[model samples]
Target: MKTILLHVSLVLCAVSSLQSRTWTEAQTGRKLEADFVKVQGDAVVVRAANGSTMQLPLARLSEADQTFVKEQAETATKPATTAAKTEEKSSGKEDAKKALIGTWDGYMADSDGSRHGDIRLVITEEKITASNPRGGQEMGAGTYKISGKRIDATGTEGQFRGKKYEGIFDLDSKTLKWCSANDNPNSSRPTQMQTNPQAGQFLMVLEKK
Candidate 1:
């Protein structure tokens, strides 16, 4: 029993010794010692050595950190390298995810195109803060998650509290088009346009700043 207890203790120690590395964020040059959690559509989420969670954009990471991501991207390809199509697809997703970092600004509008609001949205590797003002009234500041073109958002405070929203990002044009959900059963969110609005929907068009 004594020998068995000693071996178990040794195993636990080895497991506990597995430590995460400290990573430097590129845009801010801030360092975070953490274990990588996963790569979401637009950011890398990590659990810090101190137990804090963070989300950072790839472009926001330091060059070394970006190199780390490139290495990871290469490493991720090893398993699927046997299939050409799968490799291309994985590479595409990785590229698209990286391009999503930056600040985007534009305007929001109601479905009828008559009423509009100013919009400013900033995206880092891990968090998105979006603000849309209606006639100088701040409706909310939202935090969002992106996967492919799909976006899911939650209002952190204000009247937007307890509300959820959905939207899309057009990666190529650096445009983000998203909206709050319509309350009525038959209605859908508005489509993004440069000039006019669609019916019964609210739309926003923000270009990267």
Candidate 2:
């Protein structure tokens, strides 16, 4: 959990770096060069070039800086609201339970982008039926839960039965990318869409069928 949090923090910092700019104090007109982190309550969090983070009250910033901070905050939140509404509408429900209920055809690829094997999946509200093909021999059965872009699944059949997996996924109307790591003994969930089979991470690119 801490790893995930740290990864997210790093990503946010990188984004802030790209948006680094000058901020002016309203009363003294003192200018500070910093990267905008986030707006907390009535204050804005910023990171200096020296890697120090500090919070300044919105009232202390110039009008233009305050406007910039509010705009940044709104821009950050709009996509989440839009995505939630889109998913709810597409699933024809208030949640994501049925959003992934369908047949998917894809191949598992190794770190070097070599296809290991072709696979098919039939997903329902809570269960996943995996196989080599649409009607070929069954590979495994599992139960999964989705929270935003993260998927938590546990195998319930075959050799992998009782094994837990954690992954991140990007799903749309046509394509889905599922990248995961086995969480049996010790493995961290993937933070990006890449695979390292030697490290127990895998990537699957699938298309709805």
Candidate 3:
């Protein structure tokens, strides 16, 4: 009986020692040896014996390492997360500015020496609408597709006209030139005249508004 009791105590001590030096994944409930874990600021940088490093949230660490890891995580995540957020914001701004969202003045001249006069284009998030100030008439709304520097607009041309025209508007120079190709179906001419088939192709020139 004495020998059996001693063996049981030895097993208990071994189990306790093992538990003290290990960590378990809170989400998946998987256990990992503690010696393989390293505490790097706000991030718990873990390096396995095999030499692979994985960074995790500091909160995921054990209580004993929490204090030190929390501080490190804060410092490390701040700059990294802030930089990631800044990059996302910059990407969004570029996307919004890629299209001609504001108002634009446009003119189209036909091959017959007749000009269609000046027109105002107002593009909103939902649709692209245009109007002719001379007649105070709405040109109806249509959908548009804008690429890096090219714009293809298609919309209603009012009661007497059809609603489809593909043109390229270059926003860099604030110049817009498009043609009414829907009216003349047989004409193979380019829809609008511009230096490039792209929009936003001109050099960026900005002044304080």
Tell me model 3's lDDT, rounded to 2 decimals: 0.47
Per-residue lDDT tens digits for candidate 1, residues 144-193, read: 66665666677776666666665555655676666544433454443454
Top TM-score prediction, candidate number: 2
What is the alpha-carbon lDDT for the whole of candidate 2? 0.77
Cα RMSD (Å) per model? 20.4, 15.4, 15.5
**TM-score for each candidate, following the candidate numbering:** 0.44, 0.53, 0.40
The sequence of per-residue lDDT tens digits that candidate 3 reaches over residues 1-209 is 32332232332211111112355655666666544243433344455556565665545545544543333335444666789988997776566555446776555443443454656667775567767756867867677765444455565545423445544444445554443334334433243442222331211111111
- Count backbone clashes in candidate 3: 7
Give me candidate 2's TM-score against the actual structure. Answer: 0.53
Give candidate 1 misplaced runs (Cα > 4 Å). 1-91, 112-115, 132-139, 179-200
Largest lDDT belongs to which candidate?
2
The backbone clash count of each candidate, in order, is: 7, 0, 7
Better of 2 and 3 by TM-score: 2
